[model samples]
Target: MSSDLFDDVFTLEDRFYTEGYNQGVQDGARAGRIEGRSFGMEKGFEKFLESGRIASKSLVWANRLPKNPQPGGASDEKCSEACTLPPLPKNPRLEKNIKLAYALVEPDTLSTENSDEAVQDFDDRVKRAQGKVKIIEKMLS
Candidate 1:
């Protein structure tokens, strides 16, 4: 081939290679961002569900316990104190679960995107919490 033709071919090849490389980089970066965002949102939503579970579980156990009786007249105070129900025993396992739940739903937590899977997961968690509440009620009863 002539020198000019050879030079022209080389230049065209270099231009096509550069364009392809640049396009690939852009495409790869865009895909990476999307994947990262989706993964983060899923994790965040899981934490949110955990927080809900903690709240519901705590509520189930807390208000069920009887409160201490108030003291009346001086003469009756002693009797009232004795009649008051003893404090309910704390469940260490429940406390640990509550603490974990609180940590999961912090203000700085990331939010899940609006997707079918996320919605379904959220609904499932809510149903689980409700079932727990019902079981607790039966136990207390």
Candidate 2:
């Protein structure tokens, strides 16, 4: 009888332990998923923001590029001298860099999915855009 009683106690303890472990595993998995999603969202927002900044800068550079005067018509000045920045000197290298940077971060071409391949492609494009922006800045300065 004593041995049977002891077996019952041990069985109860083992059952409790198993239940606790399973519950812990479930909770941990849930928490992990939540944390992963939050982290992914934050990183995505940061990356997109950086891309936007690069794109905006590229647009400004493009607009500042000197316009080719038409052969027969007078050049139409769009901005008043007080508001306008002096046009950027016409340089093939500068023009190319600005276009490349803009293309790298073009919104329509970029993916919004959370897949590994998409994330990697986005990162690669942003890194290349950043490098191009730095080179353009140095050239302009």
Candidate 3:
């Protein structure tokens, strides 16, 4: 009877150890994937800079790559934004050009540079924020 009890305990221990090993394997796999993705993104960004679609001097601006360059992104808002992997190459002639190009990647920061149609549509929003366009939004009947 004691021998049978010992065998059962041993089997339970083995099962526990197997579960722990499997969990470790899963965690390791997930970590490896995250690391691999980060490495790949860095390499791809570097390769893109080298492709000459962007001028050598443009590297100065490109180097200022935002970590989270998505539309309407605040600082470090990468997860909230979706930056295209391959950005367009353009020859902008001014500092504003650099800023605008950066906006092309991350547009949320460029609230002022929203499309002309969008700007026209939001005139009322600005008035509302400034407390200028307050109609009787509701009537307490």
Query: Which candidate model has the greater TM-score, 2 or 3?
Result: 2
**Per-candidate local distance difference test:** 0.58, 0.90, 0.46
lDDT of 3 at 30: 100
lDDT of 2 by residue, 52-76 (tens): 9999999999988877776888765
Candidate 1, after superposition: displacement of residue 85 in Å? 17
Which segments of candidate 1 are over 4 A away from where they belong? 11-13, 70-141
Error of 1 at 96 (Å): 11
Candidate 2: list runs displaced more than 4 Å. Answer: 11-13, 80-83
Write the candidate numbers in order of decreasing lDDT.
Answer: 2, 1, 3
Model 2 vs. true fold: TM:
0.87
Q: How well does each candidate superpose onto the true structure, as a TM-score?
A: 0.46, 0.87, 0.33
Task: Check candidate 1 and list the clashing pairs.
Answer: none
lDDT for model 1:
0.58
Give me the runs in candidate 3 sitting further than 4 Å from their true place: 53-141
Report the Cα RMSD per candidate: 10.5, 1.9, 20.9
Comparing 1 and 2 by lDDT, which wins? Answer: 2
Our model 2 lands, by Cα RMSD against the true structure, at: 1.9
